[model samples]
Target: MSGKIRACYACQRNGRLTCRRTRLGEPCLKTYPLECVDLLKRSRVAFQAGRTLKEGFRLAQLEAVVQMLEEHECGFVDALGRDLHKSTTLDECLMVSEPLGVVFIMGNWCSPVQTCLVPLVGAIAAGNCAIISPSEYTAHTAELLHRLIPFYLDNECFHVILAGANDLPEVVELRFDHVFFTGNRKEGSRIARAAACTLTPVTLILGGKNPCYVDQHCDIAITAQRIAWARFHNAGQSLAAPDYILCHTDIQAQLVQALKCYLIEFYGSDPRESRSYGRMVNLEIFNRTRDMLWRSGKVAVGGQVIEAEKYIAPTILTEVVESDPIMQQDVFGPVVPVLTVNNMDEAIVFINKQEKPLCVYAFSKNNEVISRLMSETSSGSFCSNDSVLQSLMVALPFGGVGASGMGSYHGRYSFDTFSHRKSCLLRGTRFECVTYLRYPPYEDRNLSLMSWACTLSQRSQGWCQIL
Candidate 1:
């Protein structure tokens, strides 16, 4: 059998055995699958073999990881296309590398190329092992990862686990050095809890109802077009994508009209036929988003769904109330809600009331406005006059706060995550009178001298202190 197939079989067998063992308390022959055990053994051996952090990884190793990612990228795209009927942009695929001993739990809505692969690459470049648990909603992508990892990576050093909701507790209990998760607030909490039991450091990348604010002074055409692209990209299933729009009431109508034009231009008159648009991952998610659309608020643009195909058309809602389902939820599918506000202060206030988002985007040329927003709102990252692109920067720290998530990693940050920084101090052999004074002495003269010496030593390193 091909290596990929063998790896796939191994993962499948292990997953079944793990689930069965977890649920029934059965005595399985293996505590973990052979592949997992082998990988751990190899990693431990590598660590013990005097492989310095710098020497543990090689450029060739990174290249190999990239190559494997590329090999699976084709399969991943095909699988995701089959699952969602939408292919991710090329910029997304270039991201996956290897693990720096930090694993990322990717979200279903994330493009396999960027969200799943790139973080993997970041970890690998940092010379760490990674264990990816892809979103269950994106089963095909997850399966592809299970197959490709062992084929491309050293089976003894890199691994992927196919886990379900029930297997989460066991997976989290493994005492991984670091845990990186991308999902909703509820599940993020559960992952955090599991990591806490082991005191494992965690990096959570979660967001809720991110806002895109447009000032009246902003360029309407550029603002609307960027907003439309950000809001509708990957059918609006991005953490950093604009969740809602806040604009000054004076320019709200104009901006909304411009946005409508841009949406039609980007996705065409019939977005259902647009190959660029993607579908919801599964029927459950489709129904959940559909219910959110039907039960709450007003639909200003598209609210149509093709249930059999699990498709929700590019949608835009206006005047959505805070109590509306769309407002309350993360809206992981392609649906944009636009809310009009009086000014930047009101917009800031509105954002402050909700959970801190993974990303906050503001479109304004004014430095003061950008400065004020940056200073006032707390987010994992911020994009001024742009959206979703901030995460692409390798130098910046990427993570969330409060309910959104925690920890940050990108570029060297990934290296730091997997590394244990130990401090060592060497004592010198030089002896002096000060050292002798520290010996036992209870006599008045010695006590007085010791006290005076100590006082002098506190003032300066001098001969008086040596007395």
Candidate 2:
């Protein structure tokens, strides 16, 4: 039946499903492909049956998910490593996150497993049926999730569709309670538009060119190290990572030299040989990032690219102009650009002129400088004296604004996103004497009494205050 994927798990073979999406005999699917609208309809039926309404049911499902994570813990780590070159230390960020209802979660490439499981797990915790659409870009990790999730989760309430982003046009048009997505602004806009047809609520954790500002009065060495770590993490393909830097004219040269030293100390002379650094997830991303080299900025360090291995060294550019195309686009790779700003005002002006970012990083010992950025600009999240570290705090909500995204999740926010609060009232059967006073009366006394009863019951100096 088309309801369930009949494709063999070994060969990923199924003419019925593969024929519609991809060609024959090419390992067409890395995971089992199922119709998304069908799953949404099924989940809605389950929701209507009040199956997911109980807190016990919600916790049990979450426990089962925890069990799955425990059982296949190594598989997830191994798969992510193969896909993103993520190390054990770097893997901690993905482990943190939590969700929404009969929901569809569209995962992105940079942090594939985290993007998929975080939202799905949260939905289950909130007692909502969910169907996960892990990104096809991270094939190995997505395939592994395809195999494990069904065995661990309830198939009737929880589902995973092994398909590409292209498959979602049909899914979005259908009436879904909610949709949680994490990706680029272009795709996020499309998802919002599609979801709008049904007036379905959506949580989009989209990306943009997040700005990191370095002031003259701060410690350049520590600033350089932290910025390098944040920017180069996962080979600098992070949604919240600093896209470009604004340095005070006085400290520009010092910061660059400090960044240059940290690059060699952290990733070695040739970063390609380093295990901690990651490569491009796909050719399309690599092509986009590789083209940034053509712009008219000085590559301060690490500009090498190996097309065959999909590796780009941790590179930094200086003297970058606002007119450059790289400044306009989200450089979702390990490319960092530094532009000189006269002072805090110029940096704030530059940041405000662009679309609101997912996060803003400001490094300064001066509390006033930090406060100015915090108060003057708009972003999904803000951190003073740090870079992209705000996302690591599970207590804080993470999402974007403007071209970045809308809706937020993490901690209690995740539960609130998926759980629709039903305002309830309980009335007693013994109140007939008081209740009957307001029912179908044609007397002035009855009307007066009814009005008095509806008013706020209060006493002034032990006497009734009803007017």
Candidate 1, residues 1-467, lDDT tens digits: the string is 21211223343444332444435655444345456646655766777674534433676677788798778888966765565453211111112334335454444446654556666766676677777777777778888888988999978767778778557757887888677777778877888899899888777777677878899888899998888888888887777788888888898778878988998999899998998888877788789889988877688788899999988988878777888888888878788878888889999999999888888888888988997888789887889888888887888877787777777767777566555554333333343444455667567766665564444322122222223
Model 2 Cα lDDT, one tens digit per residue, 1-467: 25544344333322233343345444434455467434555776788787986778999999999899789989976875565452211001112222335788888988898888777767888888988888889999888888899999898988878887887757877778899999998888888899999999999999999999999989999999999999998999899899999999999889989998998898888899988889999889998998985674888888899999999999989878988878989989999999999989999999999999999999999999998898789999999888877886778888888888998888777777777765333344554654577677458977765564454332223323122
TM-score of the candidate numbered 1? 0.71
Q: Per-residue error at 457 for model 2, in Å?
A: 6.9
TM-scores for all candidates: the values are: 0.71, 0.73
**Each prediction's Cα RMSD?**
24.9, 24.6
lDDT of 1: 0.73
